[model samples]
Target: MGAGVDYIFIGDDFTGASDTLATLARAGRRVRLFLDPPDAAAIAEEGLDAVGLATEFRALPAEAIAVQMDVLAPLLKALSPRIVHYKVCSTFDSSPETGSIGAAVAVLERHLDPALVAVMGGQPSLERYCAFGNLFASGPDGQIHRIDRHPVMRNHPITPMAEADLRIHLARQGLQDLLLLAWPEIEERRATLKTHVDELMRAGKKRMLFDACDQGHLETIGAALGGCGSDGRPLLIVGASSVAEALSGDLRPPGVAAPAQGSRTEGLCLVLAGSRSQVTAAQVKAARRFKPMPIQPRHLADKTAAGAFAASCAAALAAGENVLAHLAPTEDYRCSGAELSCKLANLVAAILDRQTVCALGVAGGDTSSIIVRRLGFRSLAFEEQLDAGVAICVAASDMPQRDGMRLMLKGGQVGSDAVFDRFVSAMNTKSPTTPSGLWRHHP
Candidate 1:
């Protein structure tokens, strides 16, 4: 490897991290996403071009984020890779008090002391775009709307976007004075991009945002990032998985084909949909092979009721029926998403203790983070791309029936309506590469 690790990314959530892992691995880059901090052996893994750390950062407050970064800064500094990417959501729907992107950058900058800090906007693959320093995202209606007016994100229960101008939105979160390198500059084939960025750095411009809406735009952004940075100090980048997409073209040589597809996993599969997003609700409605198990937030509050709920889910799977556990569409969950996630995780643990499933699927950003963390998985590797934002990952763990399990982790807004049905069918195949392990009866 050129360096111990060529690129490093810290995802704001588990779903985003898995997506980025898929993006990089599909590009033929050797990479791993660790749920916890990697030890020396992990960093020293042979032939790996990139290393990523997936966190529940998107669910944490500034103080909690700072505390976690304290443990991570030293290890990250030791890698000293060419890039340290603070990967965030494409919609950039983060709040100052919760999942504060600016607070995180401020902390990381103090520790890593990067030569430059930049934000790469727009992941066209996800239908999120940036123009004139304003963010936009596609809605369920397939209409591109400014982020603030985005149908789904506007009403997002947490960290909703209300400002389309990224500068103002970020300033509220403490990331101030961002210089925009708009799309026009990127479009004109301005060969001076790298040179201009260096000049901006010299002028005390600590942070910059690069606009992108297409693959060509990403190429320009990547070219600019590729040219900047010192020998020992890597540039710090913040954005979605598009950061990895851009880097693939700029840093890695071409002709790295994706790995062969694994075979479908056989036997029963368990899916948990803890998101209230309309996308997930639609997916749940469209599922046919999976028996719908509606979970109410109130049902999880009482220990007795939660135990009974878990038993019911186990019974369905035990009866040879694939189970799709989702939040009931009826009531509003007055609890925080984190609270709901923990409760849902408990159900997964309980079900696994009673029934062995070939694969596990979880929908929801916060729910995936909490459940995967609780599942005791050491690392997640790119297994397959089931859909646009949906990645089927392999879980490496030392726990019962978890090792070599395939995980379909998706954000609420990711995947098509038939994603759950597809997940079940994908795992029901007889292929060998498909993991034969997942949640099994512990006894």
Candidate 2:
């Protein structure tokens, strides 16, 4: 119900709403985000007169789509947003259900004028927009600009032509000057990113901006930049969720250290796992011997512990430590998508304010796209479709104050051992780090 609010972000998860709100807020817009399903209690808690649905359509089965529409239709009529922005995923192709767009549009059409609706996808698909010219440019403010202009704004899955017309609508909004930070791809991504930085600096924009395509992107950016914050110290934040999963058998590796406790203290890793089933004395023994290095772990299965862990990771990142966060799915744990996303966005905003570089993330299940787009990278095209496996994404702001972060979503069936090794190896090899850092030994 607040006045002068220009944007209302709705997502199935909190991170998307939070990220979009943060970006728009930084740009001096009055934004309110609704991260959960619209209900009387949630509406009262957020004190908003408007709402946006941020859920990804593909996450639901085709049979459920109609049911979802039945629920959303009334909600749209009740909230009556000036513009209903439906967030889409360029990488999602599960279930052959035509995904979230069609489902969202179907519901919105029942209550609002179709002219008031807009559809947007995150960073992974930035190239899909024809407006991307140099991939690298500098703004007059001495800031690097990765401009994006897409041709599709309102295309439904059922109607392909709506996408083209949507582009015309975007052009009218004066979004042509909108600049985005580009992620490094192949050798050229980094080079292109670096070139844009140089151009921005030459134009008098010397502040390093961060935006990651995934956690790998964050690690890659962190590694390339030598893991130093603006104050010139090594980034030492922990990836609590990943660490937690490791302790819980969700991330078990063959050589992983067993948990250990001294006479006066219990194993920190065991305590973090917080699962009576997963965190046993034997598991603790195994955790103590894990190679590489050990991070402080948290109990993600426990809602209270997970919230605390998320908060702590955010705090560390805000303090300029390189942090990784892991999230278990709703099915595996009690955490909700909206709650997790809100916590992440809050932490990212805090880090940005400190000007300390850090990464924010979520892992496990279908959480990657929701979290990554929340941070504002337009989605990119994936080489292969994800098939009941892990989905990892990283989102970073171009500004050095905000550390680039990753969201790694692994599936239940993926072996924890292989996942951890591959994750660490990938991060170490791709991330730029000092000679004395963990990544230094990586081949």
Candidate 3:
């Protein structure tokens, strides 16, 4: 059991899953993320220490989330992992209707039935903090703002965060009676921390939150969680990629080493974005090498328009040029978010069916999930860190043409203005005439 994969995670979105992949791999762990639960033979073949399933529940309704988790429950129970992490966004922006974190916790609890369910309070590596029960994150302007007051999240299209106190926020989604171990309490020695945790467990406080304001705090929380698994009761943790970082004992600065150069085959580089986030919009604007093509909401529902759009993109890629297909930054289409995602995915799939691409970049969590699933990729391996929470992965597929395709998945708010540029640069660094190192897994 100790030699097998130590952790199994179900990320709320593809971007979040990739971030955890980066966290574990950078810590020197052999990790792999599957589009679905793989068999024992597949796990052994990959030689993995961690496995994850990428999902788009962050953009789904509560009923939809329940149905999705129901299918995943039995799969998780069969793995018998040391820890099962339900990865959420660091800011924890969710509502009852869409992206219900509590809904997921309840579903997982009913199935796995672990002795304890822990919620890690913050991920410092991403500049997010949890202090005295409130969540704070760095805004796009580099200002520290309470999550509820953060400029971007407060006005987020899908799940706007209106509560700063996580207790209150989660309470809205029907989660209550939570026990919190604040930072001051966490700063004490390991013995004291362990005693306090034991006491809480004895008191039947199965759902608890641990304060994590900095790297040191996260390490302490990590040690506590690591200890629990050794004691024969691995906790069901709910939090961000920081949970992976903590468990792996890797809190070093992210993106420390140069990202591995991607495959540079003589094919087009296609970058697609379904996020209207300011950060993603900036990246789209900065991606000067690619031809920008915007798909309107109306076109998504019309097959003729969608096919035409796909044709244009295919033509662009066939001309030995890159293409950036995205929604305009100013467009707001809430009701059509899912439809637009599917359309974008189908559009990309169609283009890929026509032209060969050296690499593909997907921006937006839901968009990444839909695209990856639609493309029929079975498994992925961590390649490199193209940005803060962004990873370039190598796809393993049964289709020969799409096999070993390079993919970059990014959350809406992650990456810098020049992230798209860096992606193109990564592609250019490799010799177009030679085979790519990304074809083989380093682990």
TM per candidate comes to: 0.93, 0.33, 0.91
lDDT of 2 by residue, 382-409 (tens): 1111111232223334433332233333
Error of 2 at 316 (Å): 14
lDDT of 3 by residue, 220-276 (tens): 888777767555455799999989878886433543432444344544689998888
Winner on lDDT between 2 and 3 is 3
Ranking according to lDDT, highest score first: 1, 3, 2
Those runs of model 1 whose alpha carbons end farther than 4 Å from true positions after fitting are 1-3, 250-257, 260-265, 430-443
Best by TM-score: 1
How do the residues 331-379 of candidate 1 rate in per-residue lDDT, one tens digit apiece?
A: 7767777888998888898888888787899999899999998888999
For model 2, state the Cα shift of residue 349 in Å. Answer: 23
Error of 3 at 324 (Å): 1.1
Off by over 4 Å in 2: 1-6, 12-16, 38-56, 90-95, 116-360, 363-365, 368-443
